[model samples]
Target: MLERLIESLEAAPMVQRGDYHYFIHPITDGVPLLDPALLRDVACAMVTVMDLHGVDKIVTAEAMGIHIGTALSLMTDIPLNILRKRSYSLPGEIAVHQSTGYSTGQLYLNGIEKGDRVVVIDDVISTGGTLKAVLAALENAGAEIVDVCVVIQRGEPELGRAYTPLVTIDVDADGVRVIDTCR
Candidate 1:
């Protein structure tokens, strides 16, 4: 179903950072030109599995997750809330600290209200740091998380709640190998 994403992942360049094999791809890195077809495919896959009914908003981290969330929002006609790296000092803004495998930063979340049903989407989930922070912030804001999903999964990192990943892969110096494809 996601042939293009599969092929692109396989062809992605892998860089070794210490013992980690980081694959640079459009979906996560925003390099090599993000194909619209791939984004659409991912959004389609998410809709098939994620329960969007009664969802009041679509939420995602800034930067990488924006495009993926945008595609999903556009397709679903749901409002999107982007968590930012910098705080705007907005009245209801909530700051969340996140530590990823490579970087650590505080993400600012705003606009989600109590009892609002939300669906969280991201480009990839490697260490689950960003998603974890996002989920925590959302829950703290009293938002009801309807579902969570990512376009790509690179080895599992424990996020408190279960999330659907369109594709699962194993990376090494050789390249990215597809371990599982959802959908």
Candidate 2:
């Protein structure tokens, strides 16, 4: 189902950041070029796999998740919520702290009201720092998490919260190796 995603992942280039083997691809890195066909394929695949029914909104962290959330929302007609790096200072805004394998930053959340159902989507789940912070903020905001999914999963991230990974891969100095896929 994720044919384009898998192909892109296999062809992704890898770089070593300290001891971390980071794979750079269009979906995660926004480099090389983001193919529209690949994005459509991923959004369609997610629709088939995720239980998105009754979802009030699609939530994602800023940067990489923005595209995923946008595509998925377009496909499903669901509203999208982007937790941004900058604050709007709107009422009921919540600040989040995220520490990932490569970087750390503060993200702010808004628009998600109490009892709203949401599906969280992201580009990758390496170290799960961004997703971890996002989930915590969603919980504190009193939103019901309908589903959580990612396009690529690097290694096994102990995110505490359960998540659906569309494809799993292993990154090395050489390149990225495909490990598994959602049924």
Candidate 3:
């Protein structure tokens, strides 16, 4: 099933490469449009796997990770929580947490509870800084992470033994490259 999805994604003319073994596809010609159908398909695929593995909730970073995390939540009928890299004036004590996103920076999450089973989601995985911090937060919050879902996975350092990654691209080396046809 994943093989077919990989073939479909590879054949799609819209898919393009980015930094850190990442790839993005424009559903429309411009404006960073996201296709609901594609998102649903990806989410369903992830849920199928998660169901087999038994995951309870979906966790992810703020901003773009929300897209994949929402779809997964819907498909799995699970709650979604986000690990925020930025504080949006959310009512809380403003605790100090650190993380590295696909880029370098500190990250945070508010309102996460203890002992929740979670699956992290993201649009892509590059350097794994963000993922590492997210896992740390989940541990701090006392959530048991089962896995991670992503649209693309670039070659970078692993996020320790926390979880496994599910992504469109499995970067085998140190750099992000657009597949032959993506260019």
Q: What lDDT does each candidate get?
A: 0.92, 0.91, 0.58
| lDDT tens readout by residue for model 2, 1-183 | 687788888888878888887788999979989999998988988898899989999999999999988999989899999999999999999999999977889999999999999999999998889998999999999999999999988889988877889999987788988889997
Name the runs in model 1 displaced over 4 angstroms.
Answer: none
Alpha carbon deviation, residue 156, candidate 3 (Å): 4.6
All-Cα superposition RMSD per candidate: 0.9, 0.9, 5.7
Backbone Cα, N, C clashes tallied per candidate: 0, 0, 2
What TM-score, over all chains together, does every model reach?
A: 0.97, 0.97, 0.69
Strongest candidate by lDDT: 1
Clashing pairs for model 2 are none
Instruction: For model 3, name the residue pairs that clash.
Output: 100-129, 100-130
Candidate 3 whole-model C-alpha lDDT, 0 to 1: 0.58
